[model samples]
Target chain A: TYTASALAFALRNLPVPVILVGSQRSSDRPSSDSVLNMKTSLAIFKEAPFGEVVVCMHGTISDDYVLAHRGVKVRKMHSSRRDAFQSINDAPLARVDFPGMRFKMLNPRFIARGRREDFQVVSKFSDRVVLLKFYPGMECGIIDFLVDRGYRAIVFEGTGLGHIRNACVDSVARATEEGVLTIVTTQTIFGRVNMNVYSTGRRLLKAGAIPGHDILSEVAYVKLSWMLGSYPGLDRKDYVELFHRNIAYEYNPIHKDSLFPVWSHEY
Target chain B: TYTASALAFALRNLPVPVILVGSQRSSDRPSSDSVLNMKTSLAIFKEAPFGEVVVCMHGTISDDYVLAHRGVKVRKMHSSRRDAFQSINDAPLARVDFPGMRFKMLNPRFIARGRREDFQVVSKFSDRVVLLKFYPGMECGIIDFLVDRGYRAIVFEGTGLGHIRNACVDSVARATEEGVLTIVTTQTIFGRVNMNVYSTGRRLLKAGAIPGHDILSEVAYVKLSWMLGSYPGLDRKDYVELFHRNIAYEYNPIHKDSLFPVWSHEY
Candidate 1:
């Protein structure tokens, strides 16, 4: 969901407009070395020197030229070929040929709008946290182990968006109240957590969770670490509030774009 | 990273125009409850339903009664009751319960929009697939066990976005390309595959594998079951392509909303 988003964000926000490209073909294939994929991507990147996002994928032939895809517009075909990538609901920002003519590339990467110094790693992650994924008949003692081991936070990958066995809530609550900040992320990759929508999630929230907001679990762990690390000297009250703040785009309360591109692990 | 986005998206897209007026305080708190929060949210969701998305967190008894938070705007305030949740690079969408009363409440959450469907459960998991997550210094026999079990698919939760130690790659390739449908996902939850980003990711992708595309492990398990079960008769060509399809928003090629919302879990 996010591999491309992070790459897109990096490119669009970068000082230069580097075109993003990926090949569906296994590089190992006899003829599938992504030779054309790389050539086309390089063409798109060199298209314009200014800031922009572009994804180039195989177009028509096994050698069918290529298409320049928009970062946000791109989707996966999963075919194991350069064509595995496709444009989503939106249209491809533009299209171009392979490295045959690098000079013809229109959009060049350029980060001219912002200060260079501000090019900081906007993605902050809470490294100390671990996801104690709850499974059927999961041992409650796991929570004890996490807490005893000094885990700063535990984002439960609950059954739904957020729900754990009733038996586990108090233990979680105890952990949270003990200053081992506990939160819940969904085992489901999609969908939102409406604790009130169900008896289960509601109970967990009431006990003491700072909802994960829609941050992916991996993102949550890293963000939590960043937050915890930031508030090293604060007390419980402060710690709880600190977690709520959008320290790094952690909890984007309003912007949808902030959530999209759900930038995550590198592919 | 997502709880905020969950709310952010709820406000942005869900046609109900549900203004999320929530309280940090629950109904049981001394003079606490979401009463005022609910009232305010209802009014907003009811009135001026378009043009923007807003979030009213208690702005200030500490000037923190409920600041109308924007989707993308978030800042990490170092010290304040509402300090944690701040506007980044921008101001609040509109403050609620503070010095003003704008966008009155409307029907409590009306309805969510754009629900994606048209997918089936991957029930064949019983026949084969397995998720092999890596830990430091893992043994070689682990792969042997899955292969021995005659598993049809083996998904590795790589260190980052689908990366494993060098030692495991050869075995993984030999086992999967040999017909195991081996795939890779990141241990980190948010990102998707970028086989080209690193040599490791590239190598794995080349070894006859598919990238998990940020699909969470929970979904990965079910989806794999569904895919393998449904397409048991197909060739690797068709089988691998199935992984990249956007069957039910499990992995949206692109999401328009900025923040996913506080409710990222999808139970």
Candidate 2:
């Protein structure tokens, strides 16, 4: 999720559409939903409505439709279900009717297609970025290992609302001082990443770690990779500004209803 | 999830009941669901028919009841919600009614309470264990870092069915040779960890990575700590046996329907 966002951000000024697609079931399975999903995604791609990074997948298990979820707002919810992917905190960009081959707008904020002359590709991605998921009692050596190895960026998948053990705070600070782009996301996998809400988060922020907002950890890693690769000459302040900016719909202001989609009756 | 399972497994051979309880909402909020959930959990804990680690949470959005999910089988599905926790691959142990304070049996395999004389506490836990989540392009230095630090065990939260990058396999073999209990679980967060199903997985198995079956990564970490602390003198073969054994309902064979709940119908 992070890499695509970073790539999209790096290529934000361009007119090209970047769509990420994956199959929940293997093609060999008799009950596989990959064929229909691929066909629906291809149909959406043919008349691409937006020059942005987006994810295309089966919106529902009925094989009648597919959803174009914004790249940073999508997640895989189930392990093996045909319709495991879902949009988090935001509605999908468009829903495509498989039978009629018609596209219906869902989120009006989606960008529209522009002239082909505006297209550009910046494929420079740094391989020095590392993603680390934090757990209780994780040693500081892991952070030191990354720093010592000359990694340019580190994305942490922290517990709850972006928290890591206090013991590792010094290591994070050291990495930040050493010019590593330290970023924080949550393992909760849903909800916004806000570093200002709690002390642990604030400590991380003080240590020079950037809050990933609502971007998925994987996405954050990718974003860092792209950012580091494309803007190697940019200052830290400029990089931080670009990291926080919503260049391609990576961060969404969460709505209460999005958290309890199944229990809508309660509200 | 890991802490609860470790505590439960440590106290598994005892006669006392271990109940894991948490509220989905804060108590001070007007719309908070904490009070009812707590009351329901307390009611279940008082009678506590099943002598095992079980999680008590709202069965549904309704205020009338809660479900007792086995500790190792439960997971927090949503980022923030009253009904976020759910039994991953098995039915909950029981359902408790708030008004009547009644307990209805759900899963029949729940361990029945035995004589109180069998009650015992095993508080010792090994601190030399670490949990790592694998991602693409991760450097092998992480594995080397752990091995150099004298860590006795590692539980890898691998991508897809318990598979890691091929580059890390040799380090895993080295860890095994140095007497570290290397284990593999899936980052998918659902489904079994089957290393034999794929070539990469088979390679990991050949490198001495033990498949954690259906155990969650966090739970696997805790189990390893507890197992190592309790049986510090055991041989590798016996350690592997204990790792695979269903010590405290951590490895339940999955049911098809459990993967897709009622909300799946909408999808």
Candidate 3:
């Protein structure tokens, strides 16, 4: 979803639309929601307002509607629920009513369709990228392993506000010295990755890790791969610029309302 | 919060109640909630119905009540908010009303206070335990690093449904062979850790990683440290038995209503 959205955003000037869809339950299961979800997604694909990349999934457990989530903002929250996919930190682009075939716009800024001649495809992807989730006791040697394997980019799924164990800092610095592009995203899925809040995060910045502002780790991985693959000859500076830029809506500004959900006093 | 809860739970048969409290915002700020939160926690400590380890924090941002959450089932969800601490998969043990100092029971299974002879301290903690969070493209050398460090146990904060990258399985098996106790918890935070649902999880089981069964990764780390410290002579089998046994309310059965919050459709 992240990569597809980045690609769509990078080529937003084009006339073509990109729709990413998936099933929560298998088609064979009696309780499977796969068929309805697929049909609803197809319906949205044929007539969505924008040419951007979007994810269409069951908005609720019932088959009444499908949500068109901006690909960059969507996430799979549950392991096996039919309504697992949710738009994080932002509302879905629109909701597509099932049987009625009606569209309700949620976010007002969606782009409109344009001429077909502007469409172009950029399919390059570098396989030499890695995503590493940091924990309390991870060893520094793991970073060395990536550098040894000729990995060009590493996206860290770091702890609170984008931090790694202090012991791992030297290795990250070594990786930077060796010219590996490093990025940090928070493991807390809902929040932004801010490397300026703590000394550890500051040290990481000194070690040359770019803070992935509010981008999901998965999206960062996809974006890094897409960037490296699409522009094979770019230098480290160029790569960093592309990594931080909001090619798609991947870097949404944090909203106060989105920080925490409102709770009813009755609970 | 996790360590405090584990310690309190380990000594739960005590005659006195154990209360764990933290302020989301520091005391100096003008909008600081520290004073009210502290007063509410004190009210709970003096009159809570049980002798268990319970977390006392703001039940709501309004300062209307303080929730006494079972230590084992509690987690810090937000980085910087007055209502950051929450009870996962279960309702809080009790809610204490402000001003009036009223205690309303939520969960009916709380244990009552007992004799002083039941109180015993288990202060020994093995410093050799480790916690590792797994992510894509992580190298196996991390496992070897722990084994080489003479670590007795590892708690893994794995991906969805308790999974790690397939390439790291052999390292886990090697650690198991070397007598390191391995446990798996999900990074998702809200759900249970079930290694039976996916091939990667099953493989982790085969590699001797015990499913932590909804125990938060932080709590698991604290529990393992406490267990190893309390019973230094126990072998791998004893460790496994102690790992699964709910000494506290840490492994409560999931409540259906707790799966997701009720969202108002007006958004």
Considering only chain B, report the TM-score of model 3: 0.93
lDDT of 1 by residue, B1-267 (tens): 122333332232344333445544456776664666666666555554443345555544354345545432332221112223443223344434533555432212212332234212233433476665453334445576567767777767666446777777777777865688877766544335667777877887777668877565445555565677655677887877876764533453532222221211011
Q: What is the TM-score of each candidate against the true structure?
A: 0.42, 0.89, 0.84
Off by over 4 Å in 3: A1-17, A111-117, A120-159, A162-175, A180-182, A193-209, A232-237, A254-259, A262-267, B5-14, B99-101, B126-130, B136-154, B165-171, B198-200, B263-267
Candidate 1, A1-267: lDDT as tens digits = 234444443332455454665555457777673777777666656555435445666754357467665453344433233354544323344455443544333222223423455544444333456665554444465677667767778777665546778888888888887788887766443334456656777788777876765454544554455566544656767766765654323232332221121211111
TM-score of 2: 0.89
User: Of models 1 and 2, which has the larger DockQ?
Assistant: 2
| DockQ of candidate 2, scored on C-alphas against the true complex (2 decimals) | 0.33
How well does candidate 1 score on lDDT at residue B224? 64
- Ranked by lDDT, the better of candidates 1 and 3 is 3
What ranking emerges by lDDT with the best candidate at the front? Answer: 2, 3, 1
Model 1 chain B: worst 10 consecutive residues (lDDT sum):
B258-267
At residue A57, candidate 3 shows an lDDT of 81
Q: What value does the lDDT take at residue B55 in candidate 2?
A: 79
- Model 3, A1-267: lDDT tens digits are 544556665575546457777776767888777777778777777777777788888887778788878888776665455666777666788787888878677776566766787666676767788877665555677689788889989888887678997888898899999989999987666557778878999999999999987787878887888898888888889999988887766887754554355443233
Give the poorly placed runs of model 2, Cα more than 4 Å off: A1-17, A22-25, A60-64, A97-102, A259-267, B14-16, B24-33, B59-64, B97-102, B261-267
